[model samples]
Target: MDVVRRNNVTVTGNPDGPVVVLAHGFGCDQNMWRLTVPALAPDHRVVLFDYVGSGRAEPSAFSEERYASLDGYAQDVVEVCQALDLRDAVFVGHSVSAMIGVLAADAAPERIGALVMVAPSPRYIDDDAYRGGFTASDIDELLESLESNYLGWSAAMAPVIMGNADRPELGEELENSFCATDPEMARVFARTTFLSDSRDDLKKVRVPTLVLECNDDVIAPREVGAFVHDAIAGSTLVTLEATGHCPHLSAPAATNAAITEFLAALR
Candidate 1:
């Protein structure tokens, strides 16, 4: 398969510089990294791609069964890196893509230099010993909400997920991003994101990792970030004041700075 066109891969910045791959979370494409990409592109090789069924990717590449699990998405990450011949690249993933990075790095450890997880959670559903910030019932309710008004769910839930009551535009932006995705694809991605468990994968990460935790993310709580930090050996945890699940959109400056600082240390 032509991985480039398969995922709508785009590359920018100095060809000789270290590579940085930005993976957008569910409900969004690579456009979500617009604010942060420019900052990294000047000094690093920036790679951006839309997962199959996302952005302008070839729709034929999206297989329902393949995408039913995140390992498929992880495979996409590795293939993108392989096609581009990327090595020792910094993989920055938002929300669920963060876990996707984990899986990708585990599969091809040498390709990834480090990982930066923004508002990530291995499991969205809470367990008796773990507080993932959402219960199984809550996940069902969330699916129910999305199904009840599949079209409107994105617009309505954006504000709640963003957590910036004072900033209406931020929520509006997220709502737009969410609603712009293909509905059926969005549904499957959401299910894979919330229902899957990747807790054990954390312990297997060999590359340096950073977990960025927002203060008031309704989806991934501070505790969940801490748990990821603890589970991944020697992982750095940075608490941000972004107050949203999508900090790359709501607080790009701080998010960018945190990522910059982490990448600099690897240099």
Candidate 2:
């Protein structure tokens, strides 16, 4: 299958500029990055794509077995980079995609040079001395509720995940994005996202990295941000004044500024 068509890859901006790939999180498509695209387009080659099971990606390309682990998503990133022949591209990943970027960068180090993680959490379930903002039972219940009724779970959780209750539309948009996804696929993605642990993977990131986190994100708390920063050597962590897991959507201006500043430093 053509990787571009399979992933619904979209490329734009200055072709000669350094490449920057924008990856969205679970339940979100490339459209989620609409607010941030323009900011980078003038100076970077921007690449956007939907994962096999999300957005407008070819549904037939989705395999539960293949996507059962984060490696599958990392493969998608690697293949997309290969298809574009991108060299030393900077990867900007949101939510779960941040860890996926880590895996992809490790898998294909030559293809990715730097990383920008937006509202990332290496683990969602708390362990001793580490607070990932959720307990094992909490995750189990969340997943069970989602498996039972994905739509209802989405409607209830989207608001909490997006935060910014003052902006009902953002929550509604997230809910719609969740609803648009295939329930079975979303369930698999959800399980893979919440249950997986990537703390050990952080040590593999040798490139320049910028970790962006929200001031108040229910999904990934400040402790999680500090954890990621401390885990990765020589990484910069910026706490946006935003109050949501999806800061690129809730606070695009701040998110974009931080990302652009990071990109400038990279260049």
Candidate 3:
């Protein structure tokens, strides 16, 4: 099978319309985009793919060293676009994937026309003058939880991590998504995601960018989103009324409207 197929690429919507590539965040795969895809599919050619180890991807394709860095994932994005011969396609990435989008756009400015970063965080650990919403020790504790009680950690942290405490169902969905991933693979991915520092790469973006910052995102605070917005030249930052990191899931309507407006303005 082709490389894109190995990644479990799923294409929908208008065959000849403007292309929109949706990259899921850290925990889950393309399925997480279920709530948001329908909105984009009507007008755009929507593309969804699972990262190597996360979703329905080929098990043998995942390499620990390759995925330990964001660049490897960025390469996947570039390859997906190249395999489809997509030029100037709009890239929409959530959470850690958002920074991956930034890296991809920088690497191939000609391939990506615009970028949308949902709850993006260039860095997760606070450093010097930066507020990344987490402390080094906090990350250590998180890793410890993952190691000690992988299942329990998944069940407990998913809700807290998802935010939107008022709605327990959303957290349940995230928990299920987190548990579906292979535990060992999830561990490595978590380390790679949280320890990663992509702050410097933001300025290299040569395409029009949009940063969608959600309210009450513990993983990516408002400061982190602002950092991304300030870092990328001429990037638009929109603060959604949707509370929680997974606004596309909990508040799909608002998330859909924001993405629609952003894509529309570009056209």
Top TM-score model: 2
- The CA lDDT of each predicted structure is 0.91, 0.97, 0.91
Local accuracy of candidate 3 as per-residue lDDT tens digits, 102-169: 88998887789999999999999999999999999999999999978888999989998788888999
Lowest summed lDDT window (length 10), candidate 3: 1-10
TM-scores for candidates 1 onward, in order: 0.97, 0.99, 0.98
**Order by lDDT, highest first:** 2, 3, 1
Query: What CA root-mean-square deviation does each model show from the true structure?
Result: 1.0, 0.4, 1.0
Candidate 3 C-alpha error for residue 71, in Å: 0.7
User: Tens digits of per-residue lDDT for model 1 on 1-267?
Assistant: 699999999999877888999999888889989999988988898999999877777888888899999999999999999999888899999999999999999899888989999999999989988999998999999988886777789878988998888999988888888788888887888889999999999999988888999988889988899899999999999998889899988888999999999988999
Which residue segments of model 2 deviate by more than 4 Å? none
Poorly placed runs, candidate 3 (over 4 Å)? none
Candidate 1 Cα errors over 4 Å, as ranges: none
Task: Give the better candidate number (2 or 3) by TM-score.
Answer: 2
Indicate which candidate wins on lDDT.
2
